[model samples]
Target: MFRAIRLPRRTLLTTAAAGVVISSGLDREKLPIYPTPNPPILLVDSPSSLEQQIGVARRTVVGTYDNAYSKVQDVVSNWIGVEKAVENRIKSLHDPTEPLTPSLLYVGVATLSSTIFTRTRSLPTRFLLPPTFLVLSLNYFLPKTSTNISTYLTSLEETYLPSVAEKHAIGRAHTAMTWERIKDFTQESREKFGEGVRDAVKNVEGWTGLKLGETLRVQKSEAVEVVVGVTKKVEEKVEEAVAKSFVEEKTAVDKPKEVPVKRLV
Candidate 1:
């Protein structure tokens, strides 16, 4: 049993009065007083306000995207225009019908040098031939070849590109038509497949007096079981074969070979 210690009412009142007196006697101005913290303010927007904010954000993003796209398009158009201008300038500078005389002359000199170097067994002449050929070709042949190539390309572009573009357009149209035909065929096939599936379900329902869903569920379960059984048997057979092979290998490795003794004859 627990005993409770009780204080007299007069004594308790005296203690409380003393505490209040002591607290009041202390200077309240010197005591630190902390201010109470305010609760966090949560602003919840209504549906209309939220939708308006979303619309503003969407408009900003779309405006940015359009600006960026337009800038890129401008840059690409400017680049294409500059490229065409440069190409036209180059085509105007070079004549396509210009003679290949310098290039031919360099080639002949190189060939003659090679022939002379091969026929003559003179070491100094052979040594001189290569450098001479190099100088002649570099000074004459390369520039002439480059000019001829540019001229040829310009002529070909002027003559061939339009016809080639027309052919490409025709091919693209044919490809589009072929794709449309393929799409129609696939759609027809899908419809036929759906009809066949519905017909099959009706036939099954009529024959078995059971719902097609139930029949399909039953069949699926049986197929799963059969597949599981076959897989188990195959797994067992494979494990047995592996174990047999491993044992055979281990025995072959462990078995000692007999050493043949040679007679001293």
Candidate 2:
């Protein structure tokens, strides 16, 4: 048999508590050690330098201008294309053609009509003959006439249109100048009118020995009092007249009407 050694109660409790603490610490150390996530990396962009910012702004402005220039170039090219097409079409219509055959035929028809008009005694025949000749002449001359008109118009455009444009420009400038003068005159008139009004007010003040505003206010108050008094008198007179008329009507109603009696003889 082993000999039992007696220990103090406090000593036994201390030993048990130490044993429990040691066991718990060992258990915690055995637990899976999860690594703590590194603080989230904040990737902050560095602020742009002044020169870089200026460069960016310059590029943006240049890009906008370039885009506008390209758009204008496209519009101008399209306009030029349309103008060329129209010019080509007009040139095709004005191209020269053989006119000899048509001219000879027209002359023959005209001569025959003129001879018939002179030889024929019939008035209707003569009348018809002149119209026939006229129609034939027009048919022959219309093309030449159109060509000549076109040439005249072209010459007019080149010579007179510029002068007309210049005259229009001059007229516009004159109009602008006239408008400016009118505006100046109106401004001066307004200033003069203001001054005249001020002088008139001063003159009125000197004559009346009162400020214009105060004088007007006084006159207004006096007029209002007069109007009010007149209105009150009119109202009293109306009431008295109405009351008298009502009393007369009541007296008339109260009086009995006399019955008419005819005496028979």
Candidate 3:
């Protein structure tokens, strides 16, 4: 019955890669085990799992510290790009007699703030500082000098302290902006993977005539258990192999070597 339902190959691969490949048609005991691919798909059964996967993803994408620093630079560059775009649009209006208004500056700032700050929250505070500096520079609120920026921020240190700023460098406005963007991104992602999950569940539901949600919950549990069991076995095998190799080496080193004695007679 499960074989009858066809899912998009890409979607199936995605679900499988997430370590949630649901298979109600086959017995759990009979499932064939195989080595997970290099850079194994994370089974995010809990919040900790999700956090672990996200950290791995950040390290992979950001690469070296220099690269991460460059990414922050790029964020500033993008803000400059927006500024250029806004300036060009204003010039296109071709009113030489008109002054370049704060209205244009406001538009540029809005675009910059939305795009720059809306980037994933996983980015480190240090990385955000570069773009934050650029925002202040472009807005003419502050000179983009490293020292001045540092000094100004230090003055605001009291705000960042436990007494005021909290652990993050965010303010009420930033909190609002970040949450808005996070909501939008989360909703979009949910609708995406949710469709795939729902479709898979529906296929099983058709076979068993069970409700979609209940079938999904069952499949999710089964998949998590299968993935965890497989992972544990793999880890155990690796540890055993390492221990055996160490023992063999130690024995080889400790064994007495037969040396031929030269008889003086």
Candidate 4:
């Protein structure tokens, strides 16, 4: 019967590191588009403005020193765990803890191991060499690989996230400003409309010579009739002047002008 061995969280993290390295080699344009982090409402306005806030949050959330230390710790711990797993896998091949049956497969493996032992003069090289080589190789390469992954991820965040965050923040601010402007305009319009209505009411009251709740009784004022008669008389005088000018022009045109005759001398 086989029992399951639960892998540590560090193992999972190391596996993820491998994935990240693989992904970094691929075309970045083909990567998924992700949205930026949004803080609570009204906290941010633009990217430049939010930089200070982000810094404060970073320091306060976990102290600067602590955060950095934890990162280094995680990297070291993960590498150690990964190297240990590699050692175990290698060790299992040569010296497995499980019982071995006398089957053809076992016989062949044993025969191969004995032959390798004879060929290699070094006793440690016969059994422990492969695991030691693997541990050393992983120790050297994993740090570099993981560091590259971290750098790529950091660059991605810097390139894409800040712009998105700024746009979102500015968009929100603009929306709020627009709403305020609209409300102010609406209020001003209502005030002006009310004033116009009041003025109209006053003008109507004065024109009709009536008060509020009064019947529609239009008084025939002789002043208006007199003004209209005066305007009509003025118009007639202007028309007569125009007609007289035209008549004088026609008479002047009909009158023959004496032409000077040049004598050929």
Candidate 5:
């Protein structure tokens, strides 16, 4: 009983250390890592890895999805001057009869930013698709709430952070992918993304507080777009792999067992 509580604390310290180490390996190409402290719930690094260790793959997919999201921020930031315009244009495109409201614009940018960035970074797209589908289904079926605070707060977060993240994604991906395209952009990105990375590192303090039972200033509720997005993604992947294995097993069973080959006389 005494050791159980201490185990989690020790694991957190060890995981945080591991995060720092793994993050260090990720160059600016994968900079601004979101550190997590749960060593026990480890995430998989790639699809091949997931195939190897199905359990760990579930966790790793979430981490990889996080990597995908960090890039989403980069894409949005790059859209700065153009993001607003892009957001506005898409909103109008979606609504032919009605005038685009600020609210509509907000959702538009969030969806568009995520969509476009996902195209460039298909890992997250393939990863995010099922989750987005689930959340949209949830919103459609369960959106009604009896309370006002929940509604108002949800509205507010949906507006601000997605806009912010979209803009950030644009900027950072421009740097990372640009450098990825032509190494010349590497120096350019280090200078530009430096502030973004620095700010990202600084933002960790607030989220860490949430884990410790402190309130997140930004109403992590909106960030549910991120949380649910990521969670749904990882869950779907694990489920898919499991389903695939079961299908394979069933296929083998349905077919006649192979007869042992006899050696030729």
Candidate 6:
């Protein structure tokens, strides 16, 4: 009798427990991976994979920069013929083929002209700052400045670097602007994108619109061709988040491998 009663009770307990689990609507096997409500597409533990992790990018900053680079190259290449023309006059009077010929001066002048074109390509246009800014920023926002000799090198940027304050000021301003531009990536994702970002981006778009951020793409609907023209010094962790930000329907910015820099002659 006792055995029969105990067996029935145990069976009942087991059934009740199973029912409770289902009633609670809990899936023991599944748990949310991202803490943030709007997380990036891919999460990389290592920095090397950041570039590889770039998700289904709807747009890329490199495109605009790349176009700029190509345009500048064409301009410089055209000047090469001018240099040859200048040399032609000298070639007529002397053996221009000779290395020591006076035509060498013409060659030098042409070379210098091309160098200027390169310089123009290097500088930030109305659209953006050149890669030099990123190099400077990486040096500026050092995770540990005094850790190595590089620290001293970056420190020198503060002293010898031209327009340090100017660049930083522009950088900070651009950063403020970018936060807002990012918000527009996800419709109704405004809250998910964050707070200060919305205001900053809205203001930036109001001031610069799509014209400034015209790195990867351009649209007529946008007030300007570019968006917030920012060059941030993204750390390793941040890079991972950014890389995975793309989705099939939703879009995000594509980080470029090389940042542009413009220096004086």
Q: Estimate each model's TM-score.
A: 0.27, 0.27, 0.28, 0.21, 0.17, 0.16
lDDT of 5 by residue, 79-115 (tens): 7859788677544334344333554454455556666
How much lDDT does candidate 4 score? 0.69
Q: Alpha carbon lDDT of residue 14, candidate 6?
A: 98
Global lDDT scores for all candidate models: 0.80, 0.79, 0.71, 0.69, 0.66, 0.56
Stretch of 10 with least lDDT, candidate 5:
140-149
Question: Clashes in model 3: which pairs?
Answer: 159-165
For candidate 3, give the lDDT: 0.71
Q: On residues 71-157, what C-alpha lDDT tens digit does candidate 6 reach at each position?
A: 999999989988998677444434323344434354455545555556657444422433344334433443232134344444566
Worst 10 residues of 6 by lDDT: 138-147
Candidate maximizing TM-score: 3
Better of 5 and 6 by lDDT: 5
The Cα RMSD of model 1 versus the native structure comes to: 38.1
Model 3 / residue 175 / CA error / Å: 4.5
Inter-residue clash pairs, candidate 2: none
Q: Alpha-carbon error at 177 in model 3, in Å?
A: 5.7
Error of 2 at 228 (Å): 99
**RMSD values, in order shown:** 38.1, 36.4, 54.0, 53.7, 49.6, 45.6
Distance from true location, Cα of 254 in model 4, Å:
99
- List candidate 6 stretches off by more than 4 Å: 1-58, 94-265
lDDT of 5: 0.66
Tens-digit lDDT track of model 4 for 91-117: 443323233343334445554655565
lDDT leader: 1
Residue 165 lDDT in model 4? 60
Q: Write the per-residue lDDT of candidate 1 for residues 27-103, one digit (tens) a residue.
A: 56455588768899999966798899999999999999999999999999999999999898766654555455676
